[model samples]
Target: MGTSLQHHGAETSPPPVCRFAPSTTGPAHLGTLAAALLCWLDARSRGARLLLRLEDLDPDRCRPEHARSLLDDFTWLGLDWDEILAQRTLAAQHEAALDHLEARGALYPCDATREALRAIGRRAPDGGFAYDNRSRERPLPPGGWRACHEPIRVALPAGTFRPFDEGGLDLAQEPALAFGDPVVRRRDGAIAYQLAVVVDDAASGVTRIVRGRDIAPSTATQAALQTLLGLPAPVYRHHLLLLEARGGKLAKTHLAPRGAALGLSAPRLCGQLAACVGLLPAPEDCTPTDLLRTFDWQRVTTIDRVVRWQDGQLDATPADP
Candidate 1:
């Protein structure tokens, strides 16, 4: 048995393929820039190839101009990538993945409405919410399609994640207990983030993942999907999120200031972003190329920082938590 394991060791996935997947629901902001910088440096530091992926699968929110603006924003920052791709363009692959999962009985079409499901599940401990599944034989409600988790769970390694900074983490998770049944597809005939991401990461050869900790909870569901699809689990580096002192998390939904509004040169913006993640000695102006000289993963921290707009200026102050 041990001999067989050794034989397959050589089959471990190919060389590290890192990615910076920016959602196109809005323009890239300071926090987005910071996360992208870390992901870029980590890939470069390892001499690994980094790909730029526009996660614009959501039809309702993603717009054509936003994609153009994002591409322009990255070009201004001096961030380079081996290739650029978009999630929407890969619908065939996503559908294939879904077909595979469906055949394996790993996924089933859900017909419950959001309101119906909400009536059943309970909340989670993280101040976030989760759905508890009892998705048996329910009729497909009109304009109500929900993807449900059927008492399924995927296991994870246990530890902290500082994506792309320190080495990746090994954290454990029970999918069935925590995530319950989640919607992989929406009633609008659009694919969900969970399914699309796992499929895209595997297809793009992404052996490592670097993103903000705000979505850390997504690891388990993605992990479960990977397991179901028989795909390799990429190493993860979940970094700290840029937060607002009062509102919390500097999310795209907030329509935070973009690169244009920051009023700084591309190089200077890179330096500021690098400093936010402990990649530099201070948060002064610098270029992605300049900070590449000072990149060190050990210096990265996982604590969330407060980013607020006050006195007509943007600032980041460490939160007591």
Candidate 2:
């Protein structure tokens, strides 16, 4: 890995490399479409290289069919990418990263179970149960940290860290207190999202990250990881999310309709997603290429949007014509 990038107050001059990383746990929904479109627009507008990365980290929920279907959805919606990658294919690199952290004495094996986490009863900013970093107090295995089969967590640096985001979002906080020391490796030996993403982005030389605002809360934690790993931090621009009216964000758990299941043509679905983020005046049938000329970060909405999936159609007030 390269040394930590110097922040000299000027953006990196290389043609930006951006990625649309989507988890393949389920079919692509409106929220997924919206995030994909925003990422495509941002990269295409700047004539940057865009990558489509399948985040199929969880073996339990992620399936091959879902990954194939997501690729089809992107193709149908006229979203093109310069390169593609699967997170699962890089397990060796993730393990190597863990090896690096362990060598630095920055990692510890954690045996805390989910039931024990619930017992602590602390809530994180993102509303999930916050880990109390109990593993920090435990001794490493007799052989070493890596000799254990338990989950591995990073010893996150202390003090508040305020990372810079191009979207003007406030990402200031102590990562350990905000989300606790994130698990870098699960007991099952799967590389956790936080560490995997930082390691992958650095290895791929990704310069910018454009995605939904819902991931904003995790930025500080990931930023801390980047610092510890001696990797370059990407410029971040979190776009608005397509949320369900009553249940919060549209997600696989909500059974939100996939782009194929939406019963709309490709251009029509692209238009609806574009309009939701202020890329278009209204939801008019169009391709991702059609909106590139007018795409501007300033035009994207910062507010979360409410959308409804009813009667075989998407009803988002902002996109309503």
**Candidate number with greatest lDDT:** 2
lDDT of 2 by residue, 1-321 (tens): 889976778686779999989999998877887888888888998889988889999978899999998998788888889999998888777878887788778888888888888889998888888998877866667776568788889999888878778878898989888789999888876788999988888878899998777788898899998888888989898777777766478887554444455677888777877777777777898998889878887888777777876675556664221
Which segments of candidate 1 are over 4 A away from where they belong? 1-14, 137-170, 253-260, 309-314
C-alpha RMSD in Å of predicted model 1 compared with the true structure: 6.4
What TM-score would every model get versus the actual structure?
Answer: 0.82, 0.90
Candidate 2, pairs of clashing residues: none
Tell me which residue pairs clash in candidate 1: 149-181, 156-172, 157-170, 157-171, 157-172, 158-170, 158-171, 158-172, 163-237, 163-238
| Full-model lDDT for every candidate | 0.69, 0.82
TM-score of 1: 0.82
Cα error, residue 27 of model 1, in Å, equals 0.6
Model 2 regions lying over 4 Å from their true place? 1-12, 143-145, 253-261, 310-313, 318-321
lDDT of 1 by residue, 184-261 (tens): 676576787888898898888889888887777667767777767788888888888787667477766543444445
Q: lDDT score, residue 201, model 1? A: 89
lDDT of 1: 0.69
